[model samples]
Target: MTSQIHVALRPLWLCRACAAPWPCATARLNLLAEYRNSHVALSIYLAGMLYTAVEDLYRLNPQDAPKPTALHDRFLGWTAPRAPRPQPSD
Candidate 1:
């Protein structure tokens, strides 16, 4: 069987599938598995989401907002990019 969509719950920022933090343990595992061969795309997608989450979260705490570094690490800093593919020769 397939897994359900694991989007964030927003506001509270929990995982829709597991109810953990957004990009929670289960979501992270599934993301890595799905983009195992294409980490760049995953990075791009996460970066975009990070931007949106940051914006929304900031509106909620304009004075006590989390640091950019913290948010970056939480959203996009954990994973490294995928390795390059080998070229085929004739």
Candidate 2:
């Protein structure tokens, strides 16, 4: 079977393969694996994409621009390394 390459469709910010939002689940996993060694670099890349998404989405609907917090969570939040939960004291 042929593998689908999950990529951004641009302007629309949807996944080229799954038709989901850009940086869809598969794309996220691929990116995490691809940049496993350089998280800062990944953040920088995602930030740039966020900027472009904001511009494109806003232009598409200026009357209801995408929320900054939601976009931040979508583009960069998931990439953040979460801290382990603290264990209960003995």
Candidate 3:
């Protein structure tokens, strides 16, 4: 019952970390741990809903792109279609 919901949402918890949602790492960790208790299941569900809203906001704002770095670029390159490079000019 509640356990099933927790299990289903475990990935979303990890996703929030990977996405680096607001409130900083320590605060997020505290929130997650607190929400794990059965008594706090409702809190967990609400947090998940809020996290979804945050992700939606991100999707809406292309200009607020995630901080770009070489590692991110490489990851994108792996997933994205590649174009042929032009030859060096003489």
Candidate 4:
């Protein structure tokens, strides 16, 4: 049988593969490999996911909604953009 893909499970945003949070470690690593050539694209994609997650999670439990900063950290913090390497003198 094929293994389940690590995808989000709707409003809950849990990973289908491991039942952890969506974009769990494995998912993040996969995303990095998929978007390795374009950090900007990765950032844009993650930002969109973050927006959707906030909407779904907040609606699911408005009274116990997660903090904005915490959500930002969880959704976008780990993928800090890489800086270009300095050139050596010839």
Best by TM-score: 2
> Which stretches in model 3 have alpha-carbon errors above 4 Å?
1-20, 39-47, 54-90
Candidate 4: list runs displaced more than 4 Å: 81-90
Q: What TM-score fits each model?
A: 0.75, 0.87, 0.26, 0.84
lDDT (Cα, tens digit) per residue for candidate 3, span 32-61: 567555535635454555555446545766
Task: Supply the TM-score for candidate 2.
Answer: 0.87
lDDT of 1 by residue, 15-75 (tens): 8887876888778888999899998999998998899888888998889877999888878
Which residue pairs collide, candidate 4?
none
Q: Whole-model lDDT, candidate 1?
A: 0.83
After superposition, the stretches of candidate 2 with alpha carbons farther than 4 Å from their true spots are 83-90
Error of 4 at 17 (Å): 0.9
Candidate order by TM-score, decreasing, is 2, 4, 1, 3
lDDT of 3: 0.43
The alpha-carbon lDDT assigned to residue 24 of candidate 2 equals 96
Q: Give candidate 4's error at residue 63 in angstroms.
A: 0.9
Better of 1 and 2 by TM-score: 2
TM-score of 4: 0.84
Ranking of models by lDDT: 2, 4, 1, 3
